[model samples]
Target: MELALSLGDTPKPFSLLDHHSGSQQQKMKDLGFCMGLGSTRNLEDLHIKNMMREKDDEKVISCSSSSDPSSSPPPLPLQLDLLPFSPVLKSPPPPPPPSLSHRPFPWLSKNLIVESGSQSKLVKVIDAKPLTTVSDGEELAAGEYSSPNNSNSGTSSFQMDFSSIFNGGRSFNSRKRDLELSVNLELVDATERDHRACSRGGGGMSDEDENGLTRKKLRLTKEQSAFLEDSFKEHNTLNPKQKQALAKQLNLRPRQVEVWFQNRRARTKLKQTEVDCEYLKRCCETLTEENRRLQKELQELRALKTNQPYYMQMPATTLTMCPSCERVATTTTSTTTTSPCQQAPPTGSHGL
Candidate 1:
């Protein structure tokens, strides 16, 4: 027989075993059951105390068995060391609420009629006239205002307040408009300064001596020059955005950046032309030397032909006749005095 005990508000039924033949064992089991009830309340208190202490401790469940079943049960004084089992209690932390900032605006995603509640509308600032007091019907006809928080109806019957539409907060659009206006003012100022400089002959000196005009030269910093060189190496051309970005980075006007790029490209083309001219000069020199060598070889060949021996130029035959026999003979003065045809026959013997 066995008994299970728990230290909670509700007491669960104990698992019963088969009937035991021994009366002493049965009596012992009954006594254990009765003793469990008395210690239940005390166990509950000890469990509460352990829970407070173990709040920050590692999560674990410890269990033990009695060494001697025949021995009597321990006293009702609750001691953790004597306990056989312990149940761990844990409470999970609550989940956080979903954030609206990270959520995508459904109207913008689907290209639907944009509601005022859309966060994208809060960030996007377009130049437009401010809303004026108008009838609800006219406002609905304009189709410029709609609130997601109010009604799903296409037309609103109430006069929509600007403050309420902007959620009672300062509209980012106003600040954005002010920033754009400041940038435009800066651009205008820069243009006016450029015009004044041009009028004062700041670019270059006049050709006529009567008008003594001199240009103002802009010297770029070494760092700025190096950055521009690197950018040029990456790409020789610049779009408007790149020009603007470079101008902002170098603290120069956009026109200045554009002019610098133009001058740099011209310099590159001029250097390439000089290099090509030098290459052509070298090629001309090499061709001249080769032509001179070929002409000298041709002249040597002509001299050899003119200085050839007279005997080498003559024909091999020199006709002669034997005096005693009156026989015709042919001989070459360069080889032998007597012809082979004449020597083969007797000197006095002749066909005549």
Candidate 2:
């Protein structure tokens, strides 16, 4: 369970707008050192209180003018009266102090890199002042920022300038791409081989001894390999007993198995997301091409339909000559006359 509370109960930034001097004249700025990103409701409460005080003052002024001087009761004492105020001499008021706890720059992440493996493998940003460092010279190493108790990396609490991590000719983006390619390739290859091996039945020894006992060579430490192989075989969430059994088989602690499962789930999800994204991309391209082709076809059809030639009346048929009688046929009955070859039936036919 992740808790949102910070160590030191620092009062969140409370903006005291001097309504007396100017309302919009003063710029609002964040105040106070961040224990984390921004202070909690404690800071919000103070802001509300200040706003109420200003509203009360405004109400007092408005009510006072409308009241009868003779019968109206004395003005109520204001909460602002109890608060101390220093009189400014002749100097211009100091620039509105920047809010130390203003909503952190929107683009910046509130998380500190607790453990940046090939990817940001394990991240915990519980503190308010989320482990930011000044300038670009102090980027923390891969193992320098987790809890001190972590067995893998002993010293885990180091302040580092995150910007420096992206510096030195090679950018974080490039490094991230390289890391992604490496992890992705490793995971894909492992998964594919494991799938292929498992689908081919148990990838163990084939031959048997004289006693009919088959000797199998171990590919990994008994426990470690079993844990991995079992993970590939099984589906659904593992219970404590199953986890322990798996851990024992793989020669690892239960915690290591749990973490491995967690990381594996994350990696699989990421890969799936990438695949889904690629599929969507291809789908979009196909749709776009189809749309373009349809549009072209529609345009061509439209042009063909719109640019059709106007209909013209056909001329009356007039035969210029007759083949059988060798005379011009003035009327349009050219089919009524025929040559001897056309009029004669075949020799086998009986035509009188």
Candidate 3:
């Protein structure tokens, strides 16, 4: 709005226009305009605006223009669309990246700027550097870029080299994870079997390990058992120190050695007792057979002696009759035998 002073000689033009409004400055920046101060006349003209008074009317005071019409500034363009010159005047902006915390992986680039000589510059700013990984894979953030005239149309490109800091980590981590999972699976399987056994019979696990392969008892190798057997042959018993030494040599536990010695001693004693019992039984049977043969021979001798008659005796022997018995009696002969009256029945009355 223009205001004119009613001086007695001539009228002067004054204005209450703001030189740089917020919207005007924003539009100027969008158009890639350089912001600078104006001339002294323009500054004086800007400060000449009078503040409104309570009784002043809100109406324009008309005044005539200056002598130079060509010096006046042209009006601002009313219709300015960024469509036709969009490709040349303004370059497409670099896509806005997420914050470090929200990103899937760490990206340590601080700021990415793609600048073109003929077109507008595209800028993408990152707030903070990304965090380091657990393995201490510290990414090296560099801002080494060059704008070549011919290449990329004078655009600046950034390059990064994720060198040996993350080297050998992938294979090591994968193998370690596999081993841990295997151990965990074994433990889990054993636990599950124990739970099942307990649930079925209302009892805890036994020495058989619930028939699980992971719970089977350890068996000594052939070499280990052979060494153990030789040691046992040397001495059937073992002291604590000796057992420890043997166990260390065999790569086994002292308890296992001690148990083996105990079992070996028991088995040896059992075998010896069995041998002695078998020998005694055979000897008893032999003696019984010998006694039976001797008894049979004695019975045959007694029968032969009783059946011999007085006439079958030698000529030197005599026969006589006693007054108490009517039967004939034989005298002592060269052979020793029982008398007919002993171990024999009496003769019939007709024969006497």
Model 1 agreement with the true structure over 276-296: per-residue lDDT tens digits: 345435544654675699799
Give each model's whole-structure lDDT. 0.35, 0.30, 0.34
Candidate 2 vs candidate 3, lDDT winner: 3
Segments in model 3 whose C-alpha atoms lie over 4 Å from true places: 1-215, 309-352
- Cα lDDT over the full model 3: 0.34
lDDT of 1 at 44: 35
Per-residue lDDT of 69-116 in model 3, one digit per residue for the tens?
122241221221121111121232222221111111011122233336
- Candidate 1 residues lying further than 4 Å off, grouped into runs, are 1-215, 309-352
Best-fitting candidate, measured by lDDT? Answer: 1
Query: How do the predictions measure up, each by TM-score?
Result: 0.29, 0.26, 0.28
Candidate number with greatest TM-score: 1
Which is better, 2 or 3, measured by TM-score? 3
